[model samples]
Target: MKCPNCQSENADTAKFCKKCGTALSKKSINHEEMINSMGNTKSGDNTTKIIIIALAIIAVVLAGAFAYMFMSGDSGANDSTSNTAPAAKNTTKVNDNQEKTASSEKTAQPTKTSMSILGGSFSTGSADADKTYAQIYVGKENAGTDVIVQIYYSRDGNSLNNGNMVPATVHNDGYLYITSADAYLYYPDHATINLYDSSSNLMDTQSVSLSPRSGTQTF
Candidate 1:
């Protein structure tokens, strides 16, 4: 390039004459245009840098979230795996408790019976140990009604010896006497009395179900 004011030779990049310091010509490029271009370039570069920085930050956040979720899931899975024996042991304990409960239920079923006759009421005897008399007042039984009577003993109602119902002497007042001393009476529990009717039927047999006084025969 040439400096027009001083007629001096200068480099192409020169904007003014080296000799008199005058502007040589319109610049090889417009100053304002260059400044605008530089501004545009700087803006583009800054935009690209910001985009890269944002991408890097997003990547780091994604990686951290993925690691947290993966670690949490793996920790839970490992914990479950490690506790298998205790879970199975707990199941076995529950099964044992259920078995014990079942055994208790089996023992809770109805108990064995102790009564010989289900509803029949019986005798009250003397307090003396040697002279224990066994009798229930028949006059008070069934409101002292004068009626035909029957007595059942033991479990079965029809058998001859073990379970039996027999005819009893009836008074004019209608009191049923299963055992009358006037008729040589005896009870079924006492085996020693060998008395009998002239027909030789067993006479010493007890007629009714007896409830004893004092001391539980309590089941």
Candidate 2:
């Protein structure tokens, strides 16, 4: 027989181990008990494995949920930012257009009156100091006509001042400029001016008492 305590060879009827002095029968291991212990260990190992697998699955699920939330939040923010960009640009464009239209309207405003005449007689402080000269200007509505206009200035009953008749030069926009300098050299008295066309057709005639504000006429 073998001693259970020291695995020593002994007599079959011996009750103790010769090498370690241990009682052989007391230290003997039962085959059934060892089998039961191994089974318990296998069961514990499987339980631990199942727990580890469950924890790993839970961790993976949590990570996926967190990633989904983060991605969703980031995507929403980007969408909001992109959506507002065009709206802001459109608002600015609308404001700019409105301002431009207001400016155009302001610039396009028309004049109040068509024409106004301003001229009068005045004394020249010169060698002819005592002599008062007459000046006249006639202003009226311009129809943009393509015709010549003449201003026949008569002083002392003659259409001559310094031996010349006042002629009005017509502009492209129908404005007339009296180009005769002698027209302003007449003495202040009763005078008549006749406006005639190129065909010698009388258009306007006015008689005036030459004074400071006597001939500021408008038509």
Candidate 3:
């Protein structure tokens, strides 16, 4: 190539003549085109860099949002668990208290019972130490109205003496009496009584022990 302005000979690819500092004819145009191409390439590189940077920023933003949502969900779950814990505890406590109250009520209820009879004996004479008289007393026993009772006495195991119905006794109080004065018996005697109700139901079988007469004996 040759520089037209200064008529200087130069290399074909050179833009300026080395001898006279003049521009080469075809090299000047090629150099300007290369500069424009380099500028355009630099602009395209910068655009690609900007796009990549924008994508990285968007990815960072999306990741931050996802993390925040996950944290919030965990926090909500924890809060829900915490809130329900007391309710569950209170429900259990109430159930326990109700069970305790039911048990207490069952414990407070009275047991069922039926009619009963009790008996005692004493001496009839004033000074003689001989057991003579006997009584079967009924206090407020749990029976029906005007509950009739029959008493049978046995001095020995072989014989039984049946007595009359005990005075049409109410549930409140009554008595059945036996006396050696009527039967001519003596001391240290023992007797057994079998009691029955109006329905012929056997109520009780009790034994009476008569002690000899003494001044200090407590009946």
Best-performing candidate as measured by lDDT: 3
- Per-model clash counts, in order, read 2, 0, 0
Model 1 misplacement above 4 A: 1-27, 75-90, 102-219
Q: What is the C-alpha lDDT of each candidate?
A: 0.46, 0.55, 0.59
Superposed by TM-score, candidate 1 places the C-alpha of residue 47 at a distance from the truth, in angstroms, of: 1.4
RMSD of each: 14.7, 11.3, 9.7
For each candidate, what TM-score against the reference?
0.36, 0.44, 0.46
Per-residue lDDT of candidate 3, residues 112-133 (tens digit): 2345565444545554434345
lDDT ranking from best to worst?
A: 3, 2, 1
lDDT against true structure, model 1: 0.46
TM-score (C-alpha) between model 1 and the true structure: 0.36
Clashing pairs in 1: 125-133, 188-206
- Indicate the TM-score of model 3: 0.46
lDDT of 3 at 113: 31
Give me the runs in candidate 3 sitting further than 4 Å from their true place: 1-26, 31-35, 98-102, 120-136, 140-203, 206-219
Error of 3 at 120 (Å): 8.3
Candidate 3 local distance difference test against the native: 0.59
Which parts of model 2 are misplaced by more than 4 Å? 1-29, 114-219
